[model samples]
Every structure is written in C-alpha cells, then in structure tokens.
Target: MSEFIQEKRQYPRKSLEKTAEVLDNDTGLSLGILEDVSKGGFSILTDQGMRPSETRNVTLVLPGPQGSPHKVSLTAECIWCQTITERADFAAGFALRSIEDQDEVALNYYIRDYQVAGQKAGELEES
Candidate 1:
C-alpha cells in the first residue's frame, strides 16, 4: 500500500477555468488554461511542458464584478509538473512571487465569490 502526502497550502484554492497566457522569455507567449486559483497562486494546464523550478510571468484575464474581463499579472515559479496521459496538456503548479494590492483584492474577491456560490448551490441541492 502506498500513502500520498498532502502539501499544506497557505491559501485555499478555488476551481476556476479561464484562459490565460504565460510570458516566457525564450518562447515568447504560451497559452494555458487557469484550472484553479487562489490569492496566492493558481494552476495552469498548458500544451507546452514547463520544467520544474522554471519561473515566468503570467497574465490572467479574469471576469470582473461588472462582467468585463480584467487583466492581472504576476510572477510565478513552477513548483511541479506532470503530463496528462489522456490529453496533450501538462499540469503545472505555480507559486506566486509578487502581486499588486489591487490584484490581490480582485483575486480574493473572485475566489470567495465562487466559494459562496458553490456553498449556496450545495445547500439548495441538499434541501
């Protein structure tokens, strides 16, 4: 029997599926999907495989409160990478290096809003 160890995260991540771009110094731009997000960092599923320990700047186009998309940029370092067998995409975990105050607020709002909505839905289903 094998036991898997769970990593403790500083912030809880909420599932979010949104298109984003990774700005690579050598490769220019790489497209990826933002799978889950938190105020601290987010996971990206990309066609290009990012080596572990690689760092890059990512720009996330996230939906705003008014329904318009807003751009948030952050420097991130890849913690781990794994190839998805069934798909061509590679899943990568990124740790956010730095973020602006406004960007942090926006990210927190998006995560909390989703969590609240999900909880409400679950309650409705149970009722």
Candidate 2:
C-alpha cells in the first residue's frame, strides 16, 4: 500500500517548472527555477540551499497568450529548504512578503491560466 502526503496550503499551487531569476534584494545576484506557485507563495528548485527566514526577490518570466512576455516580481521570504535525495539540487519554499498590485494581478492571471490549461488537458486525457 502507498500513502500520499496531504497538502496543507491556503491557495492552490500550479506547477511551472519554468526558469526564474532570484535576486538578493541587497546584492542583486541569485538564480533558481520557479518549480511551483500559489497566490501566497512559491517553491523554487536551485543548486544552492538557503536558510529559513532568508529573503529574496523572485522574478518570473511568463509567456503571454499572444507570445508576448510578461514579468512578475515579488519579495519573498524562505520558509523551508530541503535537499533532493542523492542530488545536488535543493527545493525551497517561500512566502510572498510583498507584491505590487499590478504584479499581483499578473501573477494571479498566470496561475489561473495554467490551472485552466491543466484541467483541460486532464479532461482530454480522461476522455
């Protein structure tokens, strides 16, 4: 028998697996991948590990429906970091600290768009 872990999140998360840039708000040099995102926070996969409570600026470059590019930036604080077993990669969870209104709109739209697309795909698969 297999057991699955239950999620305990306030908002639904969308898997992105998209490249993202993480910048240290103070030094302006950080890098990672935007693994998943929710309205309140996101998980980043990186080669480096971060300590809990550390903060950084995350910027996601999402492609628009018309192929144009959209960028959303937000301030986030690291909540937890765990190393991937047998790999050099680490996955870190972050809580959004601050986001401008425009950015928030963009982020919400991006997440909802992906969620809808994913649902449609699932429906197609089940059909």
**How well is each residue in 81-119 modelled by candidate 1, as lDDT tens digits?**
899956446888888898778877776666666533245
Q: How big is the positional error of residue 120 in model 1, measured in Å on the Cα after superposition?
A: 2.9
lDDT, candidate 2, 53-125, per-residue tens: 9987767666666667687888998999999955348999999999999999988877766633345543322
Candidates in order: C-alpha RMSD to true structure:
4.5, 4.3
Q: Which model scores highest in lDDT?
A: 2
Q: List TM-score per model, in order.
A: 0.75, 0.76
- lDDT (Cα, 0-100) at 88 in candidate 2: 40
Candidate 2 residues lying further than 4 Å off, grouped into runs, are 1-6, 17-25, 85-88, 115-127
Best by TM-score: 2
Candidate 1's C-alpha runs over 4 A off are 2-4, 17-30, 115-127
Candidate 2 Cα deviation (angstroms), residue 30: 4.4
